[model samples]
Target: EKTETNILKGIERMRRFAERFALAAAYPIAMEIIEALQRAAPVDKIEPAGSLRRMRDTIGDLDILVTSKKAE
Candidate 1:
């Protein structure tokens, strides 16, 4: 019984750690993209989707999706 409890606790701990790490990753990705856009001086501004928030797991690099429109 004790061994099973310990195993359960360990699994819980691991789950918490993963959640913590996942929450940590999002801001930097958002910031990097914003800064790059600022430096390039876009005709307007870049914006992120409201639902498109950061997630857990390893991020290799910033992934940007762009849509452009011709000037009026």
Candidate 2:
């Protein structure tokens, strides 16, 4: 019970931190990031995942999926 209570408290603190500091970025900004990645890396497949891929108006954090033929 004590461990569970501590876990719950930790979760609550993290939730508060996210609410205060994790503002969503605009779709255009996220797309720009994706474009930059494509230019910077020799990626076979590069795209945005998560909320950004779903075309959400705002994304909490940019989730990128990249695949490369050469491992360097």
Best by lDDT: 2
Candidate 2 residue pairs in backbone clash: none
| Residue range 1-72, candidate 1, lDDT tens digits | 999999999999887666343434665667787778667654454665432344435333444454546344
Write the residue-wise lDDT of candidate 2 on 22-51 in tens digits: 225456676688788889988898877886
Each model's lDDT comes to 0.58, 0.73
- Those runs of model 2 whose alpha carbons end farther than 4 Å from true positions after fitting are 1-25
| Model 1: lDDT to the true structure | 0.58
Score every model by TM-score.
0.36, 0.57
Q: Estimate the lDDT of model 2.
A: 0.73
Shift of residue 63 alpha carbon in model 2, Å? 0.6
